[model samples]
Target chain A: MAAAQDTGGEAAAGKWYTAAKATYTTLIDTGHAISSAYQLVNVPSGVWIDERGRIVRPSETAAPKNQELKIGGKTINTQGDAYVAALRDWVAKGESSEFVMSDAEYRRRVKERSPREREADACFKLAVALHDRGREDEARQWWLRAQTLSPDNWNYHRQDWSFTSEAGKKWMDKFQKTTTDYYPKLELKEKP
Target chain B: MVNRRLLLFGGATALTGAPQARATVLYGDREVELTTSRVEKGDLWIPFGDLPGINEFSIKPQGACRADICIPLPKELKRKGWLNLSGFARKVKQAVVNDGALWSFGEIPTLRGGFPESRLAPDFAVKDRKGDTVRLTDFRGRKILLLTWASW
Candidate 1:
């Protein structure tokens, strides 16, 4: 299952979907409702749902398998192989997998949404709505509010930044502010 | 002088470029066309139908609620049989963004916190590539690896 959070609607998502030729179920979340529901602050996140519809793992940074890339002459950290291995173990062993987090640990790992963060989501949604309606100036105001309210939600910032040249520069500035460990470390317990 | 037809075309292009107020309310999975109004002080107002009509939250005696969490509303927030959504939002400390035409209410805190205890995943419907609506509930019996990404 896949969800695209682009404000440009299904067409924007379709371009990539068509290119990938993915056989899995793909969906578009033009309003970013999934982000709000799952407490996802970034893209390329994954959630594991069991056959019974219970979440075994909450949203976490998920990268593709065996990716190798260099950015600005520096090697980008790709935990794709490790993540894929853990996922495979879980798939093979289900609930008994050591890769699965205990209920308490899972609850603790999932970040609590603060009032400011919730507000930021609302502001970002409004900005997207406004932008879709062609009220660019008003959308910009709400986008700025969203960014200020939830500085950590890169999706909100990046979505708005893609629309304007001025915002592009700000996105770069914020991106550079991230520490070396931009992706959260995925802690998978070894099987006994 | 340039052709009069060219001059008229340029004027029409500029007219279309100007921003216009849209009358729509987007909440949850619904996009409803609404008749929205602003108070004398510029506060936004929407019908009660539009509130619960689009988003997950409902207006109950305990105030606005979704699942277990409820944010109590004040008396002044309800006026003229319409909800001052912006006012109610402020009372609950939730963000409300209005563009003089469209009003959006932000998320409220969950009951158990942290995405609602990971019980049943909230069901949502979205269009697939072929334009058919695909729902989350459709995959209930199968294990799902829901991955979120973007083209950008």
Candidate 2:
């Protein structure tokens, strides 16, 4: 969304689409009757509530849907067609579409988290709490815990890293697997 | 390892000898300041970003949790005793900045809900598709139900 906004494509694409999507998803899918995302420390997260207002979904991926982004040929970026197709599918099929998932499925998705992955969630949560309470040192410890648990999740790393300056980024570089690991490693080194 | 000790309370502050419990803290943008205490006794939940502002406002004083400390929200932190997030942020020196574009928080919500709890419903102020300021808390005392649909 920010990328879209940066290129002055917000009008063609929609400016608040990202914020709206975030809010819409939250109210429709969480234990809170409304938005409480300030506490969200991870992605693909959900809360289940029974018809009786009990939380049928806890912190888990309620919707087990995903998209495989592949780019081929001359385009420098992925096309929006898949995104648009997904939108239409969501509106046209509602929950029946393979795109739309059920609470049961979502819960199962969350349960799929391995001990290390679940521990990563806990670490992320602890880091957020510590960061919020001004315990930078303690928060860093938990964040390292999360990174050790799952090294691929970018949100945890990016959000935390954004706070520091260039100097700080350099300091964090030591812990991270370098920029190549983050982006698809384009460098295919010759046999040494 | 920090002993994996449970923080005393879920969203409340710890009282020295309380068993390790999850706690909540409102960190300042800079690490120089913190409102640390033991974790409060509740799920360290952050509301979704779109629900009526009242929802997040209500939780302002409800008690938020961190790893092992929970800091009670000050009455002044509330707008008429409800959650005033911007005010809370300001109290901690994290001045709220709109930047004429997006209103972003530098931090993520603490997870006090047991493992497998995702799908955050946080309260935030952002421009709509038309660039109008939308405050989720504005829709209070209304009998409306929310449904979420996404493209993953």
Candidate 3:
């Protein structure tokens, strides 16, 4: 999905949309469905289902060797070996094999998000609404809450950065590398 | 050779031999109605949802139809003989052409997050990259996602 900054993107999308017949679908943030199901550890994950509504492949759909990240002068994180093997196996065994998961196993393996994650989703939504309404500062507060609720989620961080200035982008880049610095950890009293 | 092998190994299954079933359909902001008998040639037709334009910042569904490929539907919908056209279509752009092969929704926008969200959030009305108005609810039973990015 298009992230809004002071600069406009709709023009670019419109021009591209008019010239091409192929449509593109983009997810803003994968809230809980993906994290719970397929146990997605990263972005751009895939789950393939057969014609029978069965997951022929469990999760980790991207080709292991396909990952390449070299932006500017820095390198992004890479997938591990386990991630690669699972994808390779799932690709070859689409339904009808031992690798094929049963309904119960699939459901169980796809971890359900806790109430915290659900709340994070709501926070992100509220942030989006506020940002769209031009209350960017207010949106950032909600986004900050979302980040606290789900530290692993990149959507909240990224959306906030989209509105930031060049300096802000640099800060975000550093934040991605180390999240604890700016958004500090909160010590809590656990319930017995 | 490796790619082909990988496709066979990685969850790619052929649907050519399977019995044709009804496909999900959606119109602008409404679910297209259908009955078992009304389905033709394994295809379910829906009305126009909205003309392609750059109004909103994000597309609804992230993986439905992207650049010439129709993301395969989950088999559960096939078994029930009906898919949530409204829910599914809300995620992508899948307008049908005369040839029967599904058309991919074109590029609209991109979000600026270093990573995507954990779940696909409900579609909302927003301005596109070019500052036009678009709504996800307009295309029920279609796949879509809102894609936006920062200029900073």
Best by TM-score: 1
How well is each residue in B45-110 modelled by candidate 2, as lDDT tens digits?
222222123123224235533444354677543322224444544443332322111122323223
Candidate 2: CAPRI quality band: incorrect
Best by lDDT: 1
Tell me the lDDT of model 2 at A146.
Answer: 67
Error of 1 at A191 (Å): 11
Per-residue lDDT of A26 in model 3: 26
For candidate 3, lDDT tens digit of each residue in A1-192?
Answer: 222322224432344444544244422221222332233333334444443333433443233343445654544443434445643464566443444455555444455455556455545545544554576777677778877887765545554565666646654465557623231111111122
Each predicted complex: what DockQ?
0.44, 0.06, 0.07
lDDT of each: 0.72, 0.36, 0.38
TM-score of each: 0.80, 0.34, 0.38
**Candidate 2: Cα lDDT at B131:** 54
Model 3 chain B, poorest ten-residue lDDT window?
A: B106-115
Model 3's DockQ? 0.07
Note the chain A TM-score of all models in turn.
Answer: 0.90, 0.46, 0.54
Which candidate number maximizes DockQ? 1
